[model samples]
Each structure stands twice: as C-alpha cells, then as structure tokens.
Target: MKLLVLFSLFFVLCSVESLKVLVLFHMPVKSLSILGTGVVRHLLNAGHEVTYVTVYPLKNPPTKNFRQIDISKNVELVANDETLTMGYVLEHQIEKNGAYQIQVFSQENARQTFQNENLKKLIQDPNEHFDVVFSDLLESEVYSGLAVLYDCPMIWLYSMGAHWQVLRLIDHGTNPAFTPDYLSPNDLPLSLFERVEELWARIRWQFLKTFITQPEERKIYEETFGPLLAQRGRTLPDYEEVMYNASLIFANEHHAIRDRPATPQNFKYVGGFHIEDPVQPLPKHFQDLIENSKHGVIYFSMGSFLKSNSLPKKLVQELLNMFGQLKQTVIWKFETTLPDVPKNVHIVHWAPQPSILAHPNVKIFITHGGLLSSMEAIHFGVPIIGVPVFFDQFTNINKAVINGYALRVNLNYDLPKGLSAAIDVMLNDDRYSKKVKEMSAIYHDSLTKPGDEIVHWVEHVVRTRGARHLRSPAFNVPLYQRLYLDVLAIILAAVYLVKYIIASFDTKKAKKQSQKKKN
Candidate 1:
C-alpha cells in the first residue's frame, strides 16, 4: 500500500516539473513576426517545455537547443473572390463576426496542411500531453476546441496590435464585441463616428467569418476529429464557448497604443516581442554613408518580403531623381541595383534597421509602419514618413499619425510630390521629435518591462494551474444586463400603466356629462 502511494506521488511531481506547451505559428520564418518567438522563449523561462509547430520550414530555426518542428506549410488561403463569396454567406448567419473573416481565412490555410484529427491525437495520447496552450488568436475556434479536448486552459497571443480578436476569445467567444482598452469603462477619446465604425466593422466581420473563410472547415472538423474523441461523441464544441477555455491572453500591443475606455482584464501587452539584438553594429559602408553624409541621412525601407525593386521602373526612376536633389544622402534598402547612381544616395540589399535608427546622423525614416519599424523609430526619438501598403500597416500608420510622430502617404497617392512634402514636415518641425520622445517614455515607463510582464504572467498562470482568478466575470453578464435592461423594462412598464389610468378617467367623465345633458 505504501509503495502504491509513493508511485502515484512520484508521477505527479514529474508532470509538474515537465509541463509541455504547444505553440502554432502560420507565417514565414523571415517574416520577422513578433508572436512565435516571444511566447516560446518565455514559456521555456518558466520551465515549461515548448513545441513550436512552425508553418514554414527553415534550413535552420532561429533558436538553438530548443525543440522545433515544421508542420506542413501547405495552408490553403481563402482570399480570392471565389472563396470570399462563400464567406459572405457565413457573415450573413453568425451574428458575432469580428475576427471571423480573417480568422477563417488564415486558419483554413493551416487546416489544409495539418488535419484537425492529428491535433486531437497529439493531445489525447497519454505519453504526449500539454498542461496549457498558448495560441495566436487569429483563429480562436480551432485551438480553443483543442484546449477543451485536452481539458486544459488556453492563453491567446494577439499577433498584431490590439483589435477585437483578442477580446472575443477572452470573453469566452460569447460577446462578439471586443473592448478597445481592456481597462477603460467608457469608450472615451474615440469620436462617436469611430465607435460606430468599430461596431459596424465587427458586425459585418462576424457574419462573413464562417461562410467566406471556413466554408468547408466545419465538415472537415467533423470528418477528421469526431470519431477520435471520448466525450464529445465525434463532434465539435460550441463556437461561442470555444474560447472561454482560455486562461489569459497576451497582446503584442500595449496601453500606449490601445489605451481607451471599456477595456477587459485579459489584455497583457508585451510589445516588442521581436526585439532582435539591439547592439549589433551597423555594416561599415552603411555606417560610413550616414556618418559622412554632410546633410542628415534619410533611411528608406519597406520591410522584408516586399521588395522595393518590384515597383514599376517609373516609380524607381522617380525615387532616383528625387535623391539627386536632396542635400542629405539617401540609403534605400533595395533588392536590385539601380541603373543611375547619385553620389548622395546608397542602395543595399539588407540594412540592420535598429543599428541605423540608432546612428546619430539618421534624421528621418520612411517605412510601411510595421509595428517593429515604427517602434524602433520612436525608440530613437525619430519621426517617420509612412507609406502603408496593406494589412495592419494601415492601422499602424493611422495610429502613428494620431499620436503625432508620423505622417502617412498613401501608396496609391502621388508619391513624388506627396512624399517630398511629408519629408519636409518631419525635417522642419521640432514638434514631431518632441512627440516621439513623449511616446517613448510612455512605452518604456510601464510598471513592468514588456518582456518581463509577459514572463511574469506566464509564470503566474503556471503557478496557479491556469489562474482562473485573473478572469473577468463580465462575459457571463449579457449586454442588456450590462446596459441595465431590467431597470429600463420596469420604467417602460410603469409608463404604460399610467397612460391607461388617465384614459379610463377621461372616458368616465365624458359619459357622465352626456347622461346629464339628456336628462
């Protein structure tokens, strides 16, 4: 009997010391994304084992001495009109559809590569089990169900800046409305139109999610996962409750960007997750150009994956002509060689961005407003001229403008004239630098460093065994209840009763007067 008890105790201790977590990222390795690496690194810090199911294969994954496996990257994207048309139908049905559109689109691609059944089997096997799960909430439904199958808590990581998706999963996939600032009670600071815009955008997004993106995902889920489950009888869980299983959510955005009213408890902002070696020295030529150029050096980079050389030759020529006129030397991060060279400009295939930003002579940055680029620019107290192309770049540029450190020139806008003026504004104005400095302080002065904040919370969850204590009870309360519908209903009921009483008295008075007149 003593031996049996000792054996049971020994197994429990082993499991606690060796907790496994599975992280799924469905983007390219060079994409220099923020979420995948940050979460994996911190989980390891807390003594939790990690398995990063990479979407794309690498000749070498970034980290050393860590477990990394490339899941098939054959994700089927549902972006074309052919696929989007079906998603339009789903948008018409599901009333809650904020993240559904992108969620469905992105996840469908991943689903095609790795069948859902494989995920379940991985979870259910006794030898291979996870104590907790952390997933980017691009598609909460799929991962949330897996969390339920494992009977564990899930943590959501928002890849992009704060949007409605993170809130949806944290509210247990019930409210469908995402809180802008998880800490504010009122949506102050946003104009009435902006609030309305967010509402309409979410409503439209909800209906399109399942229909357009996951037109066939439901059937796929049942076919692959139904028979393998023990309690679910070979079926999927409720979409509304799928994310209630999440223990906490870690957002890449912070109160610096998303500080607004009516926020949620689940938002833990650990911005700058992709902060690479900030100390790497700049290349010698790049360093010399910035230091030697008599006028301040202006740096132009559109970020990785998008090549500046791919632009029309006409556009390239226009840029080349503009560089010849500038007193400052221009360093364009270009993929291909330029036909005409100007003494004032230099072109390189790749430039260490942070190193250049830190350089004393770099005066202005031209960017696509990717968060990392924008943040680095601000970190150095430099202003930006943004030409946002697509995706969250638009949102990032919009916020930078709102915060007053940057100006956006639309990609489709007349580039030569518009860009020249934007550059002039950054150069002439001292206010932009002052504004960036203010933002830098706010971004850096939070109670905890973003990385440390992330590590602390991750440890908090593990220590508490998924920490339900941190959850907010607001989701269980319905909208009408939140808005005091019962009180309003009572007031409305009383108004009708008073009207009825007044009408009864008037009718009696008219009948008695008529009787007296006849007599």
Candidate 2:
C-alpha cells in the first residue's frame, strides 16, 4: 500500500507540464483581482508562461514568466462611476439601474481595455500564442472571443456563486425552484409568489441578454477581433459558439458555503484557493493591540466596493454608541477617523483583514457578507454578524445564517439595536462560534489544495487538447428542448387532434339518427 501511494504521488508530480496561458480579467473589484491573481500565481509557480491583461497590474518582484498590460486608468473610471457610490447603491440603484446598465458599463470597460495601444500591439504581434485562455466571467463576452482568436480552449473564472446569467454557457440554467437569483434576497423553500418572481427574473434577464446585451457584445467582438482575424486570413467565429464552448468553469463556490443541487460537472468548486495558509503575521502595533485586549475584540469591515466612511453619519454615530456599551474592544475599518470616538473603539483607515481574522483575541466579525470576507471569516473560524448591503451579499449572508454561523442585520432599519443584537448573539451564544469551527474543519477537508486542483485541471485541459469530454451537451440543446417544451408541444397537438376526430364522429352519428327517425 505504501509503495502504491508513493508511485501515484510520483506519477502526479511527473504529469505536470508547463504551457503558455493568457489571463483576461478587466474588472476592478478587489475580490476578482485576488481570485485572478491566485490562479496566475499558481500557474506561474508551476513553470508556465503567462500574459496577464488586467486593470489591476502586478507591481513588485516581477518574474520573467509573467508579462502584464496595465489598464488601471479605465479601472479607475469604473470604480469612480458616479452611479456606483455607496450613497446611490443604498438608494437601490443596483436594482433600479438593473443588470442592463451593468452590462453596458462592462462592455464599455472591455472596449476601452481592448482598444488600448498595449493590448492592440499584443494582438498585432505574429509571434504571440497561448495554450489556453482563462477569463473572468464578467457581463461581457468580449474576452471569450480570445479562445477562438488563439485557437485554444477557454475556462471561465467565476469569482462568486454560480450566477444563472452565465449558466447558459456551461449547462442549462439551474432550476429556479432551488437556485436563487443573483439579485434576489429570498431564502430557499420560496413562497409561491417568490418562486414565480424568481422565474420571471430569469426570463427577464434572458430577454435583456438576448435582445440587448449579446448584440452589443458581438459588435464589440467583431470590431476588436475582426481585423486581427482578417490579417491572418481566418473567418470570424460565431459569437454564440465562441461564448458557449467553454472547456470548464472554475467557480468560487463550496457546498459548505452554499448547497447547490444540480451544478454541471464542468463547473468545479475552487472557492478558497485564494485564502492563505499560515496567514501572514499582523503588524507589530496591531499585534500588540490584539494581545493587550482583555475582553476580546470585535472587528468591523464593509469590504472593498462600498466605502464604510460613506455610510450615513447618523448610523455611524449610532453604531459607535452601541459599541461603546460593549465590553469588547471595537476595531473598525473606517476610511476616515471619527471625532469624539469611544475609548474602547480603535479606528483604522485600512485593516489587514486576514491577519486580524486569524488572531486568537478577535471574538466576532461584523462584516458586509461579501464572498471573500465570508470565506475569510470561515477560514479563520470566526462567527459573524452580517450586514448585507446589496446584490448577492443578501444571499450570502442568509446562507451564513442558515448555516448557523451568522446573524444578519439590515443596513436600512434599526441600525444600533439590530447591530447590537447581532453582536450580542455572536459573542454570547457559544453555538455560533462552535458551529463555525465545525464548518471550518469541513472547509479544509479537501484531498488536495485548491491551488493544485486549479493547476492540474488547467494542465489537463491543455494535455487533452481542450478536455471536450468534460463539457455538457446541454450547451448544444436549445432552451425549448432542455425545458421539454418541444415534447410538450407535440403532446398537446396530439390531444387536440384526438378530441377533434371524436367530436366529428359524434356529430355524424347524431345526424344519421335524425335521418332514420324522419324516414
């Protein structure tokens, strides 16, 4: 048995082969950046050459295997989009502006990045080539065209849950009965109306994508890649085929976090690949602070996209007042300092989130329930008080609550009381921490490291020359066929035909009887 195990390990180590890879992730969000960077780092460490195109570029300790095209200027525009501020998002702009606006903005960002002189030059070079293309599954399909341009397989990097929006590219869409919409806040066992609404949301999003977004994306694809393809005397690939022919999707999802029933085989869960093992040590002052705290510490942060300082002043003061009443020292990740702060409260413009979470003296985490934050909290085995602001944050927080490791408080109502209650529950009720610790054990129980899985699968796809066997046939099946609507149509037509024939025979019999009576 020992000899067999040793042979298997040797085979696995020897099977790894280095190849060229292209990474296109133009989204400016921090979580997406971290996820993309993790994949790039793993591939580069395995002796693979990479060309990374992104809005957030690598800054230090540059390696020869990696080449970067920095588009941080366009990323700045996206981050500072006037409508995307915390104030606007609080006013429900995310829902009101809808996915359509989001798609338009994403396309605009992609267009700008692809048109950059540096990226254009990369495409113009005849010597440039890659074995596979890994891209962020943002709203744009502009990057999917790269797979066709390079004549290689494509793998989508889904930075969050399995959003129904991209489900069409892999397998059929998930059943709305159990799978919640990305924009919805509803929990499972949805009410009849909520179920109908969820279905409607899918239909609505499909309509928008089909009629509105895809056309624009295709145009961008043609404009961006058409000339390049023509220069090589190749025909432009079909937009739908390019979009749907992904070899695999590496989603940042885990059953321990969200229990999904019917995700496709090609969709691999590699959620915590970005989390650090043997987490980095804290800065000296922060370490001292955590060590000196006698009553333990409550860490508060509102992830990256939303500015915690931009929250209403009234709510901030109310939260501070509530924190003042607690025995636990409060460490808040506020972007700015507050005047007349409580003696027990410590404010930092920026906090080392993972380091702080790893500290033994931290008792509970009050968070915005972003996926990265939630995963980090679980990684460190800390219970949570979730304050969900928008989008999938609501669903993530609710899942945490259902998992028994969290309590949620809405950002809109009863700020002080709700926060205090959630904090109290997390700190006093030992059950929350205990449950989270159990989950943390399950989270780390994978047979191989998530990073190794990523590199192995990426190599597998290249070794098999596209790993086409892993893809689902559902991508080729039309929506009508997948829903069995065509079968339903035939059955309904047969029933109507039978009823018509029977009614005709009955009419003839009645006519004959009347004729005999008259004679």
Candidate 3:
C-alpha cells in the first residue's frame, strides 16, 4: 500500500510539470486567427500554460492558465484588409506585382507588431521564462528573434503548404521542376513552358530575397528588435541563424490535396487541425433553410478575409440576379445585407461555413479557394466551384481541379456567366462528387486527429530540448557545397593537370627522336 501510494504521488507530480509555451501570432485574418487559437486550445487542453501574443483576442478569454498580450490595435495599420475584393486580387497577380506587395505588407505588420511598447516590456521582463516558442511562419522572419531571446526551441506553424522560402529555413532548395511556387497557378506534371516559368520565378525570388528583401528585413530587425534583445542581455543571433534554428515546422498541408517533394523529418503535415469534431449545429433558421431546399443548396463564401459584399455594387446585383434564376437555393455569405433580397437567395453576414459544407443538402460549394476552406470542403466530401483570387488561392484551386474534385472559374467582369457554367458542370457531373468522397476517405484515414498529432509533436519538442536531431544538416551547409560545385571544380582541375603532364612527356620524346635523327 505504501509503494502504490508513492507511485501515485510520483505520477501526479509528473503530470503537473506541463510545458510553459509562448505563441506569437498577430495576423488578424479570422481564419488564421482561428487556426492560431486552435493551437492554443490544444496546448491548454494538454495541460500546458501558454502566453499568446496576438492581434485577435479570444472573445471569451480563458479564466486561467492562459495569458494574452493583445496588440489588437495593429490591425488598423493594414489598409483595406477587410475588403479584399475579387477585382483587386485578379489585377494584382502574385508573380507580377503581388510578391512585392506581400513583402511590404508583411514587413509593415511585423514592424507594428514587434515594435509594440507592451510587447517590448514583456521581453524586457527578466522574470519570464518559457520552454518553447511557437510562431506563425509568415513572410517576415524578423520575429524569430523571440526564440533567440527566450533561448528556447522554436516551432513554426505555417498555415499553408511548404513554400520554397520556408523549406530553405529547414533544408536545402526545393526543386522547381516538381514543386510549384505557392503563388503559381500551375498544377504538377507541368508543361515545359510552365516549368521554365516556375524555374525563372524561383531564381528571381532568390535573387530578390538575397539583394533586396533580406537587407530591408535586417534593417527592421536591427531598428526594432536588436535594441530590445541587447537590453535583455541576450546577444541577437544572425538573422539567418535564427531562421535555421526552428526545431520543427507544422505545415497546414497534406497529400490529399497535392503531392509535394520529400520533406525533412522536422516537418509535420497538420492540415485539418482547424476542423472541429462534431461541428457546431447551424442556427435554427439556417438549418431549416438547408433542410427545406428542394433542389439542393449551393453555399458561396469568399472566405473570412475577402468580403463578398466588397464586390462592385453592380457585380453584386448581377450575382444576385444570376442566383435568383437558378433552381438551387443560394446561400451567400455577404458581410452586409443587400437592400433587395431575392426570394430564392439567402444572405447571412457571417457564415458557419464548415457546418454548411457538412450538410447533406449542400451539393456544391462556391469558394475563393482559401486552404482552410479547401480542406473543410474536402473533409465534408463536397465538390467545389473555385473562383480563385489572390495569393495561394490560384494554386489551391488549380490543384483541386487537377485532383478531379473542383472546377475553376477566374474572377472577372464576366464572373456570373463563368461561375454559372462551372456550377452546372460540378452539379450535373457525378464524377466531381464521387471523386471528392474518395479523397475524403483518404484524408480521414490518418492515424490520429490533426490537432492531437500537433499536440504530440509540440510536447516532443519541449521535452527533448528542441529535437535538434530531427533538423536537417542541410541547413548548415552552404549553397555551393550542397550543389557539389566544389567537387566539380576539383574534378576539372585534376583532368587539366593530367593533360599537362601528358603534353610535357610527348614534348620530351619528340626532342629525343630529333636528336637520334640528327646523329
């Protein structure tokens, strides 16, 4: 009895020593905010204490065990953030002028977020200590200084597939022949022209980063975070070193959507962690509408970041008119009500999108092809009519179309006509629905829930003190060495030396032959 009592006490003590984690995610978009919150929720549920630094605060703050350093005011710094219209997106393709825009936006946000007086105060407080730091892997790598300051292992939570830039932090350069850039709209098994373009884009991005982007980012880091780290008696690590120090990268991607190159051991695919089990039931009125729809329902949402109402008023009217004529009950997620509503069309300012997708009556989803929305649609086995807009949406929708579960309609002035045709093809064709269900089964066949898997990895990193063995040594190797250029140079030099020796022997033999002839 005494032995059993001692064992029980030991177990209780072990359980109480949960990790103290620090999370820094300030992106204010609702979907990303939800994803970040989901990570926090899992850590809290696993009995870990978390200090979350974010721009979007929890509506119902945790009563205990969670502390929030809210810099919610930073959201205002991003202009027209709430109104990412289709027109705006199509006009600014990421490959063209969009990459620059993304860089500017990321730096601005990072500047505002990391430079906040309150955040600096938190950093200055020597009393605070943490076991690990988890950060959203954004375009800005400046925030990585947090891991350096805390002297803890860092885990990057990427809300998209492994981009070439993120891969650089973990391993070596990704092959452009097979791995498409995130901003690229091309699907794999790409044509020769597409491959050339992808290769050029990759090269151009690398050049831009090395020459222009990194220098600008370094300045921001020095101006803002450098002084803060110095004050804490922590020497700031070189910007590149801090990036390579990430212990693990949790990418929000899976093979169900698109196949990717072989990843390093430290990368985890936790794509659908945002999905809720036993999805919350829809509101009574919304449930009634879905249930009563005789001709099936078409759910339309441009995701949380892009507002459907932000479309040109004329375009909105045209869409309403087009939906009015359709036999299907159209459920559009508009941020505000239209002055006149069609009898067949339903407009809700905010949507319970996953719940709507899960409905048996929801036959097709018209979406902007955000990764989270794409994952949910696949999870619920719903076919999609993807109207791809800015950023990774084009790439996502292209993959879906290639995967046989979706049809793509570009956002243009003729959107209504294009969307109508795409919708007809998706609904009337049985192949789309059948294919998505098959993919859904594969997605659901994972060994554990994505959230649980993420939790397990987070705990693993904390317990193992950064899990350095899991990280790729390629991160430490120089680019020239990784490509074997030095070896090639050595081989060429040896060949030249052998050629020189042979020529010298031939010259000596010729001179002896001349002397013999003269004698």
Query: Per-candidate TM vs. native?
Result: 0.79, 0.92, 0.94
Candidate 1, residue 145: the lDDT equals 55
Model 1: per-residue lDDT, tens digit, 1-519?
999999999998786665677776654423433457766766666566787765544445546435765554433352234322212322243222335555655566546534534444454464655667767655435656556555666777775555555565555332223343221122335566656666666566656754665445555554544554644454566544564567787766656664333446666767765555354787787777778888799999988745675466776788788777888888899989888778888888888888898887888899977767877776676789988654566667767887888888866425767788888878889788788878877777767666667767766786787787777787677868888999899999999889999989998999999999999
Kindly report which residue stretches of model 1 are placed more than 4 angstroms away from their true locations once superposed. 1-18, 28-34, 45-47, 62-65, 75-104, 116-126, 171-198, 210-225, 231-237, 501-519
Candidate 3 — which residues are off by over 4 angstroms?
A: 1-10, 81-84, 90-97, 510-519
Best candidate per TM-score, number? 3
Query: Clash number for every model?
Result: 18, 0, 0
Regions of candidate 2 where Cα sits further than 4 Å from its true position: 1-16, 90-97, 500-519
- What's the residue-level lDDT of 118 in candidate 1? 45
Local lDDT at 452 for model 3? 95
Per-residue lDDT for 100-144 in model 2, tens only?
Answer: 777777888887878788888887886888999999987777798
The prediction achieving the highest lDDT against the true structure is: 3
User: For residues 1-519, could you state the per-residue lDDT of candidate 3 as single tens digits?
Assistant: 999999999999887778889988877666788888889988898888999998888889887799999888777865455425655664453323356666667777887887787787787787888899998877778877778777888999998987787888889868998888888887889899999989998887777777877788888777766786777776777887776778999999876765778889998899888888878999999999999999999999998878676578888888889899899999998888797878999998888888889899999999989999999988999999998877888888888988999998878778999988888787788999999999999899988999999989988998899898898888788988988999999999999999999999999999999999999
